[model samples]
Target: MSQIPLLDLKAQFETMREEIYEAIRQVVESQYFVLGPVVRKFEESLEQYVGASHAVGCASGTDALILALAALDIGPGDEVVTTPFSFFSTASCAYKVGARPRFVDIDPGSFNMDPEKLAEAIGPRTRAILPVHLFGQCAAMQPILQTAAAHDIPVVEDAAQALGSTYEAPDGGGSGHAGTLGRLGCYSFFPSKNLGGFGDGGAVVTDDEQLAERLRSLRVHGGVQMYHHEDVGWNSRLDALQAAVLAVKLPRLDLWGQGRAENAKRYDALFAESGLVEAGAVRLPRRTGTGRHIFNQYTLRAKDRDRLRAHLNEAGVGHSVYYPVALHQQECFQELGYGEGSFPEAERACAEVLSLPVYPELTPAMLEQVVETIGRFY
Candidate 1:
């Protein structure tokens, strides 16, 4: 085997080039670069797809978080509870809005904030609870929602990595998409994401009418009426050009997600057939609840991860670490008073998780090569 890249956006673009180019051409002809009809149409499409009452596009996923925090009026002297295992923006968004970020541990299986730990972390000053949908699986939202509702605290979901992931309602009501399970859900359209656009873009989805209105206003300098500022905000509007591209790709998202899921299942079968799981050499990703897991990155916990990564590279297999360090342990967050053992599970995860090539574009031959390469590594 020569090599298998971690992700191949080129392959995806090849199939949708005509549609993408035409959408961009339409945007150029319309002469609208910022939020306009194109953006509004995309937002409506996203709202219906995600089953949310409202979807507000923005500049980036990080901005989406800051907007959600600002829209909810969570600021100084307030605290937001979130996991230490996720990307920086997951916790930094709270800090950006002048709120303290209270850290919690993660579930070993799901790599998401442990709902059990969240209950003990909430305090009188806890203004919001943010849970990240890590990798491509929805976090345990049911318990998290119940905990937040018990205290009347809002939950902002960092669904940046879980665009099409689903979570079934524990009450047997029905299936709920990743972001819609909370007060607000944030998504990223970064070039590397599963539903990535041509460039940076993001959005905040919500079922609350008032919150959605606030978010829409907040994304554009907090002005609902021209030049009239209601609340202090930032310049985070999503570009119309990017929206056009996203709109063209939106219809194919479910199909692409299914491809990723199929790839994940293949990995499971291959690894199991090799007896890697039982040998204690590798731990496969697990589905924590009854939900449609859209495998954004099929990551596994390998023994001697550092050695395995080096060996994979030597074998011409492309791989990457989702996170090499936990948030609490980051030097920038030292002021938060978290030390080495603040979040043991998160720390351990940072050292062991390795994401393999699982992009929808990967062929069966590529998948076989990746598995065989890793199997030989042991």
Candidate 2:
């Protein structure tokens, strides 16, 4: 009769309530809500943490994407190559800027954009390549970066689920943080994200100082000075309160990620001992082991996924599909002429992928119960 939620935000907040409240109180006392000193401090701290030269705070993760696209001057006939197996905003950002989102199939093992298939997708109109760090694991960035560099296309790392994740540099120099690996990296501070704020907030990180300045200007309606328009941009400022809350939580992020990683390892061991892998009933997530992978969500490929989901629900376990439909097959993108089997890997993932409760706050007993319930179902 034990009930487990998919993400226990309350449990996490309880541990840091006093510190979080104090940060909020300081912001409230300043009475400067939008794009103020607190937000600037958070941006500087975030830039340093991500190993980027600049970080521009924005309204939300979705707004971060739009701002990135806009700042890059991607519009009209430009095309962006990206995976079909992600949240709608991944592709929708391209659409928002009046550009085309060229979809590519994902690697079934990683559930990320296939790097080998990327070359064929790039064309004359392709302006950028967006490789999402889906499920908190960095994608195959080496090959993807090579392909993008060869074609002279900018790469945007959609690190929404991968704030603290790291990947081995393509050139073998050393380890690089997820958001610092590409031309522009976007992050989310949604209430459910690993580094969740009190509400909606996001940021774009980049090494290019000029692009960073442009992103900053774009977020504040494209103005270098107040009311002086350099370009047509939208209002997308990250609030000071959210920034303060996030800054308070920022120092503890790596420890939290380590907890999630330990839990993931425990689940792997538990599943292996339970014979689920041998029985071919459930497939665990594959880790490249090249760099740090913050387990934002521990997803599995379940045979008879729908039935398994039902059983988990009946057993008081919380679960849900990360994406039930590939972005290419969405109704809004039907004009692109993609059918059911356009991206087979992504489509199959949509049908079978189930994200379990992998939050950092989960206890060993909770994880075992989750695994036992699934084992019994299969």
C-alpha lDDT of all candidate models, in order = 0.92, 0.93
Give candidate 1 regions above 4 Å deviation. Answer: none
Candidate 2 versus truth, CA RMSD in Å, comes to 0.9
Write the residue-wise lDDT of candidate 2 on 23-42 in tens digits.
Answer: 99998899999988999999
Task: Give stretches of model 2 more than 4 Å off.
Answer: none
Whole-model lDDT for model 2 versus the true structure?
A: 0.93
How many clashes does each candidate structure show, in the order listed? 0, 0
Clashing pairs in 2: none
Each model's TM-score?
Answer: 0.98, 0.99
